[model samples]
Target: MTSTVYAPHDHHTCITAALANAKTLCESRGARLTPVRRRVLELVWQNHKPTGAYELLPQLAQDGFNSAPPTVYRALDFLLELGLIHRISSLNAFIGCAHPGQEHTTGFFICRLCGNALELSPERMQDVNTRLAEELGIVIEEQTIELSGLCPSCQLAATTAKEDIA
Candidate 1:
């Protein structure tokens, strides 16, 4: 099935929902989601795209938080532990996990033309693991699979340009 590009959801609601979910999960596990760490997560999810640590440092500082690299790294680590975010190894950046309540693997569809990232759930990613395990005799533990290509918007623009020229 083809993935449809979705309308931008309410950012305020997104953050609120994510924070609420994280808080509930933390409480259930006796984990604490501190203020600084929460702010960092907020910044990372401030934009739908993947965010680099360096990019987030300045924003954190601007918000009266420490701008140190370690501070951001530590916060990122905590969030990762809580399954609130995932690192995009190819980009050396981080993107918020789409599903927050349950533990699941995620796959990314990154648009080369627009840099927009689509987060897919574990169910959508099952085939990849099945194929990899069968073909390579490898049992996968963790994965951050990203497929890069033009997104629908860019494809539509290219098609329109070709039609206009014709």
Candidate 2:
């Protein structure tokens, strides 16, 4: 199966926007958006991809944040509670949510060719879960729907490279 791969954007803008939204939500909820939490969130959103907590630590250390694993874990837990991020169980990594501060079950479209992970919104999740429930009488409690195939850009590049070789 194939899906359109996305291009890189202003990652700085994305990280900033996500952090801003998170802060707004925390403030509205009377929750403390602590510095460690904010930095962790920023790091997660910075990549626009799933990141393991261990990998995230070095970035924090480099930034002069001498936080232990537990600190990062707490931050991740807070983000998960607020629906600002979701853990990709299969990969043991976390990805930033497209829409934060909303209730939604996470679904990912993970590309095998390039390892790009994309979030599926509520409408798409409903369509898929509805079919599963209707056909198999199975309610998806937690789903990690990672479609493994060549993403669009990778496919195009492969084809072009093949043509050139020929």
Best candidate, TM-score = 2
Model 1, 125-157: lDDT tens digits are 887788989999999987768899877777887
lDDT of 2 by residue, 18-67 (tens): 88889899989989888888888988876645789998888888888876
* Candidate 2 residue 46 C-alpha distance from true site, Å: 1.5
lDDT of 1 at 33: 88
TM-score of each: 0.86, 0.88
The alpha-carbon deviation from the true structure for residue 42 of candidate 2, after best TM-score superposition, in angstroms, is 1.0
Model 2 regions lying over 4 Å from their true place: 1-5
